[model samples]
Target: KMSKEKIDLLKLMGANVILTRSDVSRGHPDYYLDMAERLSQQRGLFYTNQFANNANIEAHYRTTGPELWQQTEGRINAFVCGVGTGGTLTGVGRYLKEQSPDIEMVLADPEGSLLADKVNGLSAKLPGSWLVEGIGEDFVPDNCDLSIADHAFTVSDQDAFMYTQALFSRELILAGTSTGVLLTAALRYCQQQTEPKVVVTLACDTGYRYLSKAFNHQWLERHHLTGDLEGL
Candidate 1:
């Protein structure tokens, strides 16, 4: 469901985009892992294995984490996000924890991902499918440090999509699919809190990247996901 807008945006930014095809209709990090492995073995290509790259963590630690601290005026009680490379959670979580160990680093995982189960100290679920993109994994990435997360929330695809549409209706912000998953978890957590807390989650990417699928009403019906639109 890669939209032309996102591809064009990346090209405009001078990102050397290499297009590839996959048989998967659901999300796949293993596919990326396989590609990375192949590219690594090729002499001319240098592979920056994102899953294990410390730089990913450092980037978030130096920039994203500090910005959040400053933006919230040091009053942030929780940091919630989806785990893609695990870089954001690990890097940002580490930085925030160093500032205040009591700060909660929360994980928002799609239903089929093993991350939530891993975080909650429960047995992992059998591999399955979820429609959300950019985050969720069947295998743990080396870059992710689960020790930093204090809480984990698992969201289903239907709920995630509904929340995504709701976000547009309510905030006039068209965020990506994973953002919906993260926000759904964050909102659920916020509602369960006994006292008020300053919580934050990332708008992971642009909804413009998923126009053909998530934003299409017909796509939802075809996928049998329309029932939960107003239900969840």
Candidate 2:
């Protein structure tokens, strides 16, 4: 997709180039890094911005906490989120802590992700595998601060997909798989709370991007993602 877009842009500028997508790059992280390097070398331009650091995490966390607080009329007492870039969790956790020292920050992780175990101070091991993308990681990112998370829940891909679909159907709000994981974690937290605490979680991205994958039963069946759809 990026290659196609780049080629179109160049064509608009009256430049001719041949570009091809390569599978030699492994994983999203490596692919992004390789693309950046290639673009810099080809265009004599380099990005000045920091790539993988904690600053973005902190900023996002701060924004999320305040927004939740305001949205819930300052009654929010807990938060649940999944970490991809880690900016959202770290930043929001910090902000929530500052606003109300007792607010609990919960990390929702996809099954087989290292984050939940890491946050709980468990021994690091090889991350398990899950179908859910974005929220699960083979390794903990630098921006994720486990210290801020009071608890963590590892959700299965099946659960994530079903919950997200149900959320859209029932609430009329389309959200991504990560959001479903977060919402499930939040509900668990809410159930455990003794009082009526306002718990919050992010909607993350829209669900449309996943329509061809999670939302389509045909796609799900083709990929064997259809087991126990009701559980999600």
Candidate 3:
């Protein structure tokens, strides 16, 4: 589900890219994460495993969380985020909670991901598929801390893409699909509020790389998203 522009950029940076099956889960040999780990061992390469890496969480705790607090002047009331490596959620959630325990930590999970239900205390179900890249997982990574979340929202691919297009048209913010998931859940959280609150979310990626997929009308049509996205 990654964009061609991103792949091209990686190639341009002199990285040997390996394309893996996107449909598989973590344990499958063909899964991207598993393949990367296996290949790294064989090649004797240092694999910075983001899922289990403490540095991933620490980076956000020291940098992103503090930056948000500083930029918002500590008036921020809630944080909305999608889970990928879970670094951002756990790290930022910990930092913000330390500053103010009342600050809500919300999860914006893709529809096919198990995280939303997991956070909301629902019974487990088999994980499905989603088109948005770089976020969501069939299983929670070691870096993820679901207890940090106060609420969770599941975002479908159709709604995410539609809102993402609307964001560009209405606000001129070219965000990636994952950002769409955040936007959808963030807006929902804002709407349900009985009092005014300063909500925070990240425009985690640039939409430029998604030109042929999330940003492409033809691609949407082919995927049967056009009909659903109409009038957005």
Question: Which segments of candidate 3 are over 4 A away from where they belong?
Answer: 227-232
lDDT of 3 by residue, 53-118 (tens): 999999999999999999999999999998999999999999999999999999999998999999
Query: Model 1, residue 28: displacement in angstroms?
Result: 13
How high is each candidate's TM-score?
0.88, 0.78, 0.96
- The clash count for each model shown is 0, 6, 0
Q: How does model 2 score by TM-score?
A: 0.78
Evaluate model 2: give its lDDT.
0.74
Candidate 3 structure, TM-score to reference: 0.96
* Top candidate, metric TM-score: 3
- CA-lDDT, candidates in order: 0.85, 0.74, 0.91
lDDT of 1 by residue, 1-232 (tens): 3556677889999877766543442245446567667767877778888889899999999999999999999999999998989999999999999899989999999998889999899975675777787889877889999988999999998888888888887788999889989999999999889999999998888888887777889988897666544454
Per-residue alpha-carbon lDDT of model 2 for 134-189, expressed as tens digits?
A: 67666556676778899998887777877888888789898777788888888877
Error of 2 at 22 (Å): 14
Better of 1 and 2 by lDDT: 1
Cα lDDT, model 1, residue 101: 94
Question: Candidate 1: deviation at residue 103, Å?
Answer: 0.6
Model 3 per-residue lDDT at 184:
94
